[model samples]
Target: MSIQPGEKLVFGAPSTLSDRLTHYCPGCHHGIGTRLVAEVLEEFGCIKETIGVASVGCSVFTYNYIVADWVEAAHGRACATATGVKRARPDRMVFTYQGDGDLAAIGFNESVQAANRGEHITVIFVNNTIYGMTGGQMAPTSLIGQKTTTSPRGRNPKKEGAPLRMAELLAPLDGVAFSARCAMDSVAHVNAAKRAIRKAFDVQRQNLGFGFVELLSGCPTNLHMDPLSANRRVREEMIPYFPLGVFKDVTANEKAGA
Candidate 1:
């Protein structure tokens, strides 16, 4: 069929990058989280003025899909890099995309310290229980008794310790402007996740202090389950450990209205 110059393409245009399709497994939450962030950036019309700091783990390649200015940082160093970027470009919106293993495990110091300083930035943390990219190892957020490559039988709370509650951990910090936890197992949950992401960005736009949104995502490939089962697990297993809701919303305290 011949196409005219003014004719629109029949196929829907791609919302994300074509050169780099996501490597995440089916039903994995990384893709959903990425979509939410992209949508928020587009909605706020800050794609050009926004800077993203990509961290390690399954989401390390987040820079490839997000259509915005981005910087690659070392494992767990996304917050540090974001701090520098925000400090240099106060007018630009800065955010960090990190995983549980990267943020709560190896990057715990950076993550907590950044929130302590009340850095004007947004942090999107994806917690999938296991280390998706690193051979399904047990991460800091791994639930008690969850089996992983490193923990063959299961994670023992006595020896391995319990899962980390990231939002609650930072909720009491004076520097933290906003902190919330959401899931991506269902449409309702996904919508809620999007709202949380948008709120985080809105806070940053207002030059608010640190804002954090921890998304309880799925690692279907690492969890060794089909899409449906993985999502089910998120509802049945993950929610109890990491309840989904807004931990704090202090946007009104921000100097600029969010």
Candidate 2:
């Protein structure tokens, strides 16, 4: 079905599944990112051939939203599950949806190792800086001085260290084919996020190995701010640290010499 501006399309109808109504908080980017993935799967005609691994955090509902074959991984094992799925079903597109805490923290080893091994899978990481599902704890991507339940007095760099730049860290990995960091705070940034998701899927379709997109999403409920203010915080506080751009694009490199 066609979607108009300001129109909220529930997960069903011509989309994919009918059971998965979005449970994300208002202004949370998980819904947008999930919808973009669903749309990309539909566009690529890979709905039946797609397998998604859902991780812990707010994104655990990904299986309910996306109609494709899906499985739930442990708190930080989505990447490992995605790797297994891709290996077993090489013809199918495999991807994992995870959050900052799930990916960059508890799952950091799994993610980095998967990328280092060049696993043929796509990873969509939602970096909201705070742990939303677990009561707004400070995530590994939480900015310096950012306040959270775990860091009520604000994050101290000496204690917690700076937020991890995941995309940049993975850019030099030979196994990584495409890596980008995007935001969903503004209209332009949202569109860019969609493009980044699409590109990661495209790389997977081409069997180009590991592809990752770190999306700077907003967590209004955890941030204890209204939707507008939460978005503004992303622009003012988060973007400076995470930034928004294509950090690595191996697809262009392959085409340049062709």
Candidate 3:
């Protein structure tokens, strides 16, 4: 593979990201999501001043893939940990990468409280619907009729209640400066997801308020489907239910004024 004299390289790994191989299973979107994060941090020239909080679950290894100062938080305590990190060192950019189980489940309260307090932090939530690391258990964001180890018969709204839409739920909070949802199913959606992630970080960098971005990802192993099939599920089923777009963005008004 030789490059022509005038041919240019349009894509390559970011300096802020590790060059090692990822441990995530084939067809998992964790790698893509983390790559986007590293790219955004690099583009903003804040990788050195960035501090990351990683919670329990598949996302716990985020520090391994991205080069940054990182702290491992207890299960469902990433938001709490990130808040502490940000308050103690306001100069550093702080963020948390969490899975649905770690965020929407036991850690929902902590996340909400942090956002409601207007903590200057960013949250990157990966919602694959099912718990990926813990043997595919039903997570708080699992869709209706979705089958999992915990819900062998499929999720029932009456018994389990409805899936929690974190982006929509948190967007209405006064402390939240930005809240958005994006999917990882197609090239266009992935680009959109990257933009959403960048905006979430921008909101934090401005010292505005809490920022949150929910990425609808695919877990082929947990979903018991091939890579292509799992991606289709995200595009077809997940997107329809969750919907992809910004639910709230305070920066819009600022930009409008400018």
Q: Count residue pairs with overlapping backbones in model 1.
A: 0
Q: What is the C-alpha local distance difference test score of each model?
A: 0.88, 0.89, 0.94
Alpha-carbon error at 158 in model 1, in Å? Answer: 0.8
Tens-digit lDDT track for model 2 on 43-128?
Answer: 78888888999999999998888998988999999999988898888999999999999999999999999999999999999999
Total backbone collisions for each predicted model:
0, 0, 0
All candidates' TM-scores? 0.91, 0.93, 0.96
> Which candidate do you rate higher for lDDT, 1 or 3?
3
* Weakest ten-residue segment in model 3 by summed lDDT: 1-10
Top-scoring candidate (lDDT): 3
Tens-digit lDDT track of model 1 for 1-258 = 457899977853235333577887778889889888988887788788988898988897888888788899999999999999999999998999999999999999999999999999999999999888988999999999999999999999999888999999998898888899999998899999999998988878777689999999888898999888989999999998899888878864444564
Candidate with the larger lDDT of 2 and 3 = 3
- What is the lDDT for 50 in model 1? 85
Ranking by TM-score: 3, 2, 1
